[model samples]
Target: MNSAANSRMIEIVHVNRTFQRADGQMVKAVDNVSVVIKEGEFVCLVGPSGCGKTTLLQMVAGLLEPSDGGIAVAGREISGPGRERGMVFQKDSVFPWMRVIDNVEYGLKCRGVPAAQRREIARTYLERVGLGHVEKAWPRELSGGMLKRVAIATVFANGSRVLLLDEPFGALDYVTRHQLQSVLLDLWDEGGAAARRTVLFVTHDVDEALSLADRILVFHSGHLVDDLAVTAERPRSTDSLLLPDMVAIKHKLLAHLGLEKRAKPLAIVQDGAAS
Candidate 1:
């Protein structure tokens, strides 16, 4: 919180990533793009599908090597996966063989935390995410939304400085999606204190971005097209979407996603205008 906006926590410098198909054609997944995410800022990467948002997050997590350019964290270049950044994927990464509590503590276990201490910490986070009642349940016993709640809890409990989420709620039902979105915001703020960690969340849904982002970076066809800062107050209400400023922001975000509002047919509208 002491740093200025210019203080960059994550830097993407002229980064490009290309993939080779089995047919020997090279696909440019990420074009030359550069941006900096400040410490404790919550950003949502919004764009159409296949626009390289996830690819970019993967590079940040060191899960994929960039085809060109570079990505750095804390002034050090990221060449491989490290515990400093945590990632949650669209697919649940919860270990099927482990119980909910065990899965939550997996990272701590790997770091050799004493079993009793690790279990207590894991349970604490699980309860925070509203999973305390199911700590003894196995992955197969939980629903899709429950699994995601656990995955998110694990990521936050790991104490990573940066959290990267790749369309994590893309598969959940509408009700569950809204629930988890709220859960994520609460986890990030850590009880109204300064945000505990920097978050770069990816989602194709404009409303999701509006609901959670302190800033939103718009991507189009592998390019960094636009950046927006959402100044709406926290614990934001969905009704705020009707406000003139929020509606304008929504249209702008949709523009980058190749979308527009459709006009109603003359017969369906009152006096040929929207009702």
Candidate 2:
């Protein structure tokens, strides 16, 4: 709640990631990206496919290393994976062998929480994500949406202060996606006072960012193309897209991604056809 926390959670300073293609060419998946996300901010990394949005989020999650520069959280360098940074990937990363409650408590157990306490914590988080009744259900038994809820519950239940999500709900249907987005907002509520968890969400969907993010960082061609602030008020829904501010943000993102719709000049079309 302090002024300092109104900004500055995760800092990616001049970060870069490079890879060697099968053709023996060096490609920079991410290039010289510098950004500081505010604490408790719902920030989205928006961009086209292969633009390195996922690469950057994985770096933040410590699942991948930056080839140059560094990423730090709360002033400490991110050397490797830490318990404080939790990640939810695009696919449902649930353990198919584990039941819903067991999956939720998996992190807690790994961290050495006591048996009874871990179970209670798992149940609590399951309830939080509206899957309490399915605690004993297997992963295969649940629908796609339910599996994602289990993954989300596991991340939050682990008490991670920085949530790094790479299209966590990307596989769900429209109805399920909206439902879970609202659920996430309710659970992430300013992250509370003493323990505010910051979120860095990666998505190519403009409407998703508009509905969920406080800021949208547009990534393209392995670079940070634009940084836009979503001024829309919270408790936001897709209806906010009707607002001029939301429309402008969407336009900016599309234009940056080279996805903007434009009118074709009649002269050019006629000349090409004639030729």
RMSD each, Å: 8.1, 8.0
Which ten residues in a row are the worst by lDDT in model 2?
A: 266-275
Residue 41 in candidate 2, Cα distance off native in Å: 0.7
**Number of the top candidate by lDDT?**
1
Q: Taking the tens digit of each residue's C-alpha lDDT, what string does model 1 give over 1-275? A: 23643267788888889998899999888888788888878899988888899999999999999999888786678989978799999998999999999999988888998999999999999999999999999899999999999999998778788999999999999999999998988899875645568889999989999988888988777887777888887779978777787888898877666577523211210111011
lDDT of 2 by residue, 13-34 (tens): 8888999999999999998888
Q: Which segments of candidate 2 are over 4 A away from where they belong?
A: 1-7, 190-195, 261-275
- Candidate 1 ranges with C-alpha deviation above 4 Å: 1-6, 191-195, 261-275
For model 1, what is the error of residue 150's alpha carbon versus the real structure, in angstroms, after optimal superposition?
0.5
TM-score of 1: 0.91
